[model samples]
Target: MRYFICALFFVVSAAHAQNTTALPEGAASPKATLKDISWMQGHWSGEAFGGITEEIWGPPSGGSMMFSFKLVSDGQVGFYELGHIRELDNTLVYELKHFHGDLKGWEEKDEVQSFKLVKVDGKRVYFEGFTFEKVSNDEINIYAQIGDEDGSAEEVTFNFKKE
Candidate 1:
């Protein structure tokens, strides 16, 4: 029993150490634009959380790239998200809002969750707690640190293939 508990502790710790990262305190956002992440444009699909996830990204336009996401589990609608990465003050910011299957928003009408840019490496764009990695022309991975009502956070990776 002692060995089992110790191994479980390490497993949980390692899970939390997966691909996402948070910005340092007082750090400034690096300059970026929709053009820098235009590679994200396309229809992508993947499996996550015991479900099928789909995302469609529109091409860069008017300083932003819009996207829509949906999750289907057990052949039923799970949730939806609408968002965009837009140029803000010559930098970039990612914003999104969640909705239920009935179109009821999870956030207040005037509220939007936002992530500030951290840096744009060769094939990866790192935001506050989210990162987008391009593996190839048809493959990409998005890592995000998601929080729960209990105030605990976990990193999730969504590996997508372009359709």
Candidate 2:
């Protein structure tokens, strides 16, 4: 009976191990590739609607990108945003979550926003847009409309340089 129990335990352990997926050999580690996004690695400060805004983006675990931003002014909080970026299925994908100061929790989150590289005016540019916001090489814009039930959007432009 003891032998049978031992054998059963071994079988179960082996089965569980086999179900685990492993990364392919020679594939770039996520951490290493995510570090490549270092181009956006910095602390940014800006102003919009009389509020002071700050944003930061950096490498995440397993070759992913992580970002967080917040806006505040006059001792009042405005908004906050967080996101992650990674290359999946041969395409760059981004997931984002946004929250308003008055809201109790995340107001919105989406993972379908994707980006692709394109050549514009002989220069490589990346573009990505979700339901209400769009980002390009030189600018990031949010669409704004009133009383649509979908919430208003705001667009902000950003330019990056190594410091």
lDDT of 1 by residue, 1-163 (tens): 1111111121222247466665667988988888789999999999987889999999999889999989898898788889999999989999988777798887788878788898999999988777899999999999877555444556678899999
Global lDDT of model 2: 0.40
**Scored by CA lDDT, what does every candidate get?**
0.79, 0.40
lDDT for 82 in candidate 2 is: 70
What digit string (tens of lDDT, one per residue) describes model 2 on residues 1-163? 1111111121212122221122234543232233334345556555655667676777566657788867786888776767766656544454555566674334323322233311111122222222112233333332111111232222233333222
C-alpha TM-score for every candidate: 0.88, 0.50
TM-score, cand. 1: 0.88
Model 2 CA lDDT for position 92:
46
Clashes of each: 0, 5
Candidate that would win on TM-score:
1
Model 2 residue 101 lDDT? 68
Q: Global CA lDDT of candidate 1, please?
A: 0.79
Task: Kindly provide the TM-score of model 2 when superposed on the true structure, using C-alpha atoms.
Answer: 0.50
